[model samples]
Target: MVPTSSSTTDRVETFRLGPFVVPRIWTGLWQLSSNAWGSASVSKIRRGMARHVESGYTAFDMGTINFPSFDHQLIPRTAADHYGSAEIIFGQFKRSLPSPEQIVGATKWCVFKRTIPSRAVVLAAVQERMERMGTTTVDLLQFHWQDYSDQNYLSALRTLKDLKAEGLISAIGLCNFDAIRTDEICTSLGQGVIVSNQVQFSIIDTRPLHGMADVCEKHGVKLLTYGTLAGGFLADKWLDEPEPDLYSGNLTPSQRKYLDMILKAWGNWSLFQSLLHTLRAIGDRHSGLSIANIATRWVLDHPFVGAVIVGARLGVSEHPDDNQKAFGFTLSDRDNEEIEAVLSQSNGRTIITSIGDCGAEYR
Candidate 1:
């Protein structure tokens, strides 16, 4: 049997993005990508999903890029009960769930630069998801981008707006829109459908603070952040280690390139060790929770953030016993000052801004 922890609160916090409400902490499913985390049979995937859903992370974010497997592997197994494993875990979720309103399902729309994804292209993608996952309407459809010059994003959002109007989706969102572009989109759409802006917002990646945070605050839009763990680089594994070689720890080429830039900006292993030391001390104050939880808490307490997305490798791993430590803790003024001092040890020198927000690198 899988060991489990109980949720500390009876009422789940909800953030309003216009007409929609969502849990503040979301579980990103990209780690389940076979290309990234090695193959797990259908049962392993279902077990992982059960762990997350049972552990208070009912919202899941996935995409259409990896193809056939996502539909065949994750979707049908859970919501549809197509897989035998689904029955077992669905029972688990029902047992632990407070009410039927607990679960939220989400996926993406990835069309990189210059690629004008029409209503047809977008619909086809959702159709495949529906057939494989055995669902009719995807709760949220995120527009993922690659090239800025392409600028066809306006039309794509317009098409997504139409889809929402037609009862095909609950909401429309953007994956990597910059501060300015996101403002322009809200202005153009006026009273259409857009609730969240999903992007890379973590302790290590402050690109959102550069102005995106203000933009979201002004627009009344919610932020769904990914990469809080710095692709697992900022974890205990790298505290004393020399920013792992390109071959280190099953990370993707894209992740390696991104982290390499941070190591350079962060003043190498020595400075990073100091940062970890700070986090370790802070964690101790919170009953010895993992530094990972401390890092996530700092972002959660920030303004305009509805939720911080944390990837759970699931079954294979776990956060501290008190996973609620993320919500239970707060960073003080001195904590912020010290964190800032460590981060300033290398700011503006980072290249992550050029790579783009949350999901832009994939494009």
Candidate 2:
């Protein structure tokens, strides 16, 4: 059964991530890696980090240094250098904290190209991540292998397991891996080796329900989900609003990306508006919670979901207080039925097949 509590300290909820216990809502720093999402100075970003930690949102998800381009977009190596500063900033912020041990830093090492998965190669990758994060041991290192045709990802994982034995990594996880690959890796590596898989799971994008959920349950792995808010489109401000123009200067890169998924892949604007209305009504039933809280609660309600990685734009914008509301309340059966009623009208299930799986859009 899913855990719930009435205590104020237990409001946010906590889950076991390997040997560490982390809050279910992690502060995602993906926005700090790109100016397209808006930028903030280092001092300002650190201050924002302080505010989140004080609010009991101490877990952070950062990107790798000089990592390959994400979202299936190819970026020049020189430009890619600008992408992973979130790790550095997070590392600095952690060091500044008197209780740095309370902070959980989860970063990624995405391999977009095929390479031999020798121990040397894998160690180099881990070392680079360690150097960038300014920590000797990574709290959680999530690996992303772009090509599935190559089976060497298994070997790379074995190397990561060896590194874990050497005290370089506390835990190992996967990012954007589909159900089959996740199952195979966990099976090949044996149980207790893989802790989590990060993917896009939201009310509109319910692809995980198809098969990934079962795989996670079987392997004793949990999901660290992103895009649960659909780039803030699943919030109150978007209700009763007209469709946005992709080319308009108003939308951030993530907003543009999710907007396309909503219109072209998930459903049209009208259907999304219907979903917003349903969520709004449900939120009202639960003491006037925000639409984003209802949406996030839907994802966290799943027993297999370990946490939801909500993006924070640091000093530029943050909603730590509001995000905390996602916890403390569980959705009623009526609330779920109301959500499913609108979902049945959309093309989410079909999108699952068309898109292939959780991370198929990127592949």
Candidate 3:
């Protein structure tokens, strides 16, 4: 069920991105592409978008990573093709609004193939996104590179910086980039070149705290985090239940991925149950908040985190109202102590070295 909001007050917080101020809780559109998460009609999706805007969740993530292997061999594909009409859908919804500028649409350009990132190639990529979104200027263009061995990603950032200067892009960001590369890009390009880095950061996956946090604090770069809820495993639904069969078709791709992390990398199922119990107790202390809300709050409480990109399955499922509960309350020192008591038992700290840093799974 989607979280319904009737509260008049605007509790969704805002953060600065270049010259624009946007909601710290952004609506992620990644679910639009695959039926593995679930799907809805275009009209219903647009209505869902309207509900989010009405509730002050105006920021959207239209950044779809394009993997060439997924596409058919014969059909020619562009980066926008992988989004499954997300950009087109957002374009229509934004145009329908009286003040479209109030909404922030952040798209991405992910390079998985090995090639030289020439100026022309980068310009074409940006232009393709502009064409699909029906906007002359992109709000934020986040770039991702698959192979770190190939150093062409720097060349790409240089070209994107030029595009930002030319007004084709408002700001440049990084997606799934590690702390070492993030520092290199920012240092080579100078200050203010990189506005944000989108990565996976959650209480269960505390890899960002290892080194990424220090680098961001040093360079004044903000982190746009996802997987904060561990694909919904951190919620109360799985609190007392036994682990699901991985072969079960009921699990979404996100669920399977995160389940592996919980069972193998982070901790055992018994330890996860203990963590859930701890979160439930914390939520109870906070005037009966939900476990999901408490987990999201824990991530948002970090000073280096700019926002948490919560996934919305459009009309299929959402939690806009419940998600807003993450704000309006500060976690007490006692709350953190109780939470850390559970985390101290897990591999949260060492997951960085074992997993090879943030976004290392993809590489």
Candidate 4:
């Protein structure tokens, strides 16, 4: 059966990531970076993180430590600020996490400068990231590559496997890796070495189900999905709205990118609106659940997916209460058929062939 959050505390659903049981819905800090999703002050970021933890989100996904602005922002003072904020958010209401192990921190092995670095250089990079996050070992170290032509991704994973052996990273996984590549990794590293594959999996993009799902299910690697909400475009706010232009000031880099995916991969604005309206109808039947909740639950119901990475727009937007409702219900066969009915008519039906498999856009 597909994993769901606990019936008593939907906010606290946990799944095994290797030996660690982590939150089913992770709080993503990709938006916490500078200008990527707009400017969020440090104080706001800290409070938002605390609130996310207070609301039972303990798994945190981030990868901006090496960014120029974020590197400067990772001083002792910033850590102190977040420590204080977390104290306030959970100290009075409940016991706060005393150590890094209490809250899972997952970061990426970024290969921005080079497609593949020497094993020593890769080890050094992981060490630097661990220091910046103020943890000795990262719970999950997800790797991403800019170019697929470089076969050195295999060597990189081999290095990560060595690091995992030493307990520097509790688990190793991939980010934006296609199904074929994922299967290759499984063959290269053995079945249980890779724990999860983080990729874009949403109503607008179900490419993971086309091939990645089979490989992951066979190899036992869970799929951690980003863009399940399609950069916030899958919610009720955009239900019947007209399409915003590419250069719209209100759209952040993330929104623009995902909006373009909708335009290119999912067809025109009207088809997207039809999908939204259908999601709204589904939400109406489920105790007035928001469109976001329905969209997220649909992804969660897929047996191959272990968690969904919903962006925590730091202090700007908070949806902890509403997110908790995602585990409150299941999408019935009727609901799936209704959603697929709209999807079949939309261009998303042909996206697998149009765009290729998961992470195909990057390649």
Which tens-of-lDDT digit does each residue in 1-363 have in candidate 1? 233355433333557654456667776555555345444554566667666555656676762232121111222211221222222333344335446345666667665435558778767866655454455665677776656677788887887788778877778878777777888888888644668888877777677877777778777778888767766766667676765665477666335644664654335667778888888887777677677878888888887788877665545544523445677557888778878888887653353555454343444
TM-score versus the correct structure, for each prediction: 0.80, 0.93, 0.93, 0.87
Task: In angstroms, give how far residue 148 of model 2 lies from its true place.
Answer: 0.3
Decide which is better by TM-score, 3 or 4: 3
How well is each residue in 320-356 modelled by candidate 4, as lDDT tens digits?
Answer: 8788889856899999999999888877757878776
All models, RMSD in angstroms: 6.8, 4.0, 4.2, 6.9
List the lowest-lDDT window of 10 residues for candidate 2: 63-72
Model 3 lDDT per residue over 68-167, tens place? 1111342232333366378889988888888898888988888877868899999999998888889999889889888899998999999999999999
lDDT of 2 by residue, 310-346 (tens): 9999999999889989987789999999998999999
- The most accurate candidate by lDDT is 2
Model 3 misplaced regions, further than 4 Å: 1-9, 63-81
**Arrange candidates by lDDT, highest first: which order?**
2, 3, 4, 1
- Model 3 gets an lDDT of 0.85
In candidate 1, where is summed lDDT lowest over 10 consecutive residues? 66-75
Q: Per-residue lDDT for 78 in model 4?
A: 22
Error of 1 at 123 (Å): 2.7
